[model samples]
Target: MVAVFSEDHVSLRASMKGLFAQHSSESEVRRLMATDEGYDPVLWRQLAAGQELQGLVVPEEFGGSGYTWVELGVVLEEMGRALFCGPYFSTVVLAATCLVESADESAQKEYLPRVASGEAIGSVAFVEASGRWDEAGVTMEAKKVAAGYELTGQKFYVLDGHVADFFVVAARTSGEISLFIVDRESAGVSAHLEETLDQTRKLATVTFHDAPARLLGAENSGWSILGRVLKLAGIALAAEQVGGAQASLDMAVDYAKTRIQFGQPIGAFQAIKHMLADVMLEVESARSAMQVGLAAASGHEGLDLDEISPLVQAYCSDVFELASHQNIQVHGGMGFTWEMAPHLYFKRAKSMALFLGNSDSHREQVAKALGV
Candidate 1:
């Protein structure tokens, strides 16, 4: 039975590999990044309708596939390998997970189906100019109004915010942090795209000028939900970083084997071989850490994610950033050139290391978990 399950896992990964190879080629990724929207809408629809990828983690009753975190990890790793540029992470991993974990059934019923169907692009706005990801980081205020609520403040580092149809915003209400849902096209809401270091991903600054919003969960109780959201997002991103590390290692090894230097293949040299070996070790080790963290987050009995999640985030970010740097070293000058793909992965590694929270912050979480 274990063998059978392993086979199933392999099959799922194969399917993802094929899907990305056909639709998310390197050229296609480059082309999509240059566009105004920074993603292929047709291919996005194909992924949603044909592959049913958008609803992979949503519960079956809520119009999703009812898949587990393990499956989402698989898809995320493949997406990272191909550098699939889209709103999948913001929509599924962040916003959808928040709704599923929140205590608001009405909000779940209203938004889950649209997100499952890929009819709406959703993002979570939590970061401010300070760029912190914890509950105390939120400074935006949601004021009580006759219409319902009014939000006034600005949020930066909103993933895919310029294109998201709606946002799950973290705001302060009566000295307590809360969550609210606001439409992107509302009268006083404005989303401006930011120029990010990684062109493959998008970020925005969203300003709420008395923008009308609806409370999501019980007022002053959204911090716990946001906590879960951050944990899940970290797990998902760790999986992606593992995949990216593998890709960088593969790129370095492949180039070393083919690129002749000093009248022989550079891979034959001891330095190149050692560098590749170290990167391979980092990639495999990080993959194991990510898999263990994914399992813990997926509700493995007797395992506590509070202990594993931060470790996974910190370690994976470090290894991926290091692997990307080593890949550039292996490629030499060509790695730094814009035309080469190593630069893209390098920037992605650096950017993702800081996403949601930086490695140092997560390391602090680990320290707190250990009571050190």
Candidate 2:
């Protein structure tokens, strides 16, 4: 693949880093985490309006920046480093990706503009109690009605569901899975907040009892659309994981250099130096893997997403989790306390490891992609 980073991309990354540094400080992250909304609307507005980040991957005709996946991946990486709390991943990565991949032009025309403008928050409701991220896991049912369709069932662990204006739901219709757009304010819709391990990211259990719905894409095509959406999600998340891992390694190295166990710094100790070196190697490897994954995702190298997606997801997920654990070990007892920021990343790494799919599942996918 060609070099993914250009002068403009470097400038954009710097701008995103500056934005997060200015707004998502540790104190700010803590303050927002305590709030019910789990994010700052003013800061979100600045990102969407001032910086136009919400539209980074959206086309210009749809009222967006018309940028490529590289830009989107970089922005997500910065967000992971800062642990910026919001509906960005839900709306921008999942929902917007579905819209972009869909063949339904009318839906794109209607919904993409709203998402681009930050006037609406969108989330995809797919996983159920089974906690499976595939088509076979969807048990929600949708029935045909006079006006439109009616859905009955529940979706668990929907990201940003409590605050979302609409949901792109996956439901079984006539023994086949289909995608539907349901308004959050509909009469039969109920959204209850879910207490997740990662409080930095909001999640909810959304139930539908004869909820009004509109079809998205084609009939029995939800699974296909979901495949593309999940691939993009994996790529974006790999970028984020690399960022988090790098930050965790940085934290450990900095602490080792300053904290003294004996006469000299702990970093001067051979054991501490070896541990930090191992973490650095893993983080850098994950970063390289993510860059290649992004290039494949952007179709820049003519590489298939099927082959690269699972590899990056599995490797990055493991790397981030390992880095977080090592960071805590390096900090000793201080890292386990709630007052420390390392715990935040530790929680996030554990939670996100299961988001799209766990490392084992992705590894399975990787093997299958390789004809194993």
lDDT per residue (tens digit) for residues 1-372 in model 1: 011125767889999999998888889889988876888777777788888999999888888999889899999999998898999999999999989988689998899988888888899999998878887788888889999999989999999998999999999888888899999989899999899899899999999998999999899878888988898889899999998898889999899999998899999999889988988888888888898888887887766787888889999999999989999999998899989999889999999999978888998998998899
lDDT of every predicted structure (CA atoms): 0.89, 0.90
The candidate 1 region of ten consecutive residues with least summed lDDT is: 1-10
For model 2, the local distance difference test gives: 0.90
Model 2 stretches astray by more than 4 angstroms: none
C-alpha lDDT of residue 329 in model 1? 95
Residue 245 of model 1 has an lDDT of 90
The lowest-lDDT stretch of 10 consecutive residues in candidate 2 is 39-48
- Residue pairs that clash (backbone atoms under 3 angstroms), model 2: none
